[model samples]
Target: MGEWSPDTELDGYEQLVFLLPEEPTYALEPENSLVATLVRHDAPRYPSALLYLHGWKDYFFQTHLADEIDGPGYDFYALDLAATAARCGLSSSPATSRT
Candidate 1:
């Protein structure tokens, strides 16, 4: 896992990038890599939390939504699907499985 860094795209948010081994799509590459970006909100209003996921071809950039949830005593989080946002340059292919 990579170290968490300030998410320049979204204010008051942070992101981390990590890679996972997967079955390769090409013979030349023994292992395909899945790059994941975890986006998080800092300074929650309370211990409770809410996780938000963006749809296909989308990435998490809804700061207002996070603000709304965080105001209600809950932390906000989002998972940018592989090949989106911070993980964009890591892989060109879309993820095949959700799990």
Candidate 2:
């Protein structure tokens, strides 16, 4: 995964880009160099971590969920899939509506 940076699309969220390994089935995929973006709320109080993922072709961007999860002492992190992030002008991401 790449370095963490302030999210340009989602307020109160941090973003990180992961340069995935070259896909062998590149022809099946849209992009050659595939990448995944991780959006997170920087409030971790425990050793455990929680990884949140959204469904395919869906709209789910709940900032409050992160806060609620963080309240339970979990290091909250959510995946923005490549395509979703891209759609939101996150440069390279994928998701439905986050509004």
Candidate 3:
């Protein structure tokens, strides 16, 4: 795990990296492991929160979707699964059949 850092693609958003111990079949090398990226806003306007998970071949790059959710007084967060992140070059691996 790592501290939250400013998101490169989304303004006013932060990203946290969560390293998993499980073996990754999509990794380019053995040393490259699996990681899930948690994207979130710095502050929540309300107590409600929305957690989203992207499907295969997808990622958490929908800023407009987050904006729409946030406008309704909910904090929006997206979980970028390891394989998807890898497909986007956000991780060290490549896309795998497994979730």
Best-fitting candidate, measured by lDDT? 3
Clashing pairs in 3: none
TM-score, cand. 1 vs. native: 0.66
lDDT of 1 by residue, 1-99 (tens): 567777646677787656645523344433545556667886445767888876345567788888898776888888766644323333332332222
Q: Write the per-residue lDDT of candidate 3 for residues 1-99, one digit (tens) a residue.
A: 567877656778887776666745553545456677788987657888999988456656788888899887899998887766555556543222122
At residue 79, give the lDDT of candidate 1.
Answer: 77
Clash pairs for candidate 1: none
Q: In model 1, where do residues sit more than 4 Å from their true spots?
A: 23-32, 43-45, 83-99
Ranking by lDDT: 3, 1, 2
Cα lDDT tens digits, model 2, 7-90, are 655777777767545633234455634456677875346888888986355333687888888887788888756455434434
Query: How many steric clashes between backbone atoms does each model show?
Result: 0, 10, 0
Error of 1 at 72 (Å): 0.7
Q: Candidate 3, 19: how far from true, in Å?
A: 0.5
Model 3 scores worst on lDDT over the 10 consecutive residues at 90-99
TM-score for each model: 0.66, 0.65, 0.74
lDDT of each: 0.60, 0.59, 0.69
Error of 1 at 42 (Å): 2.4
1 or 2, greater by TM-score: 1
Clashes of 2: 10
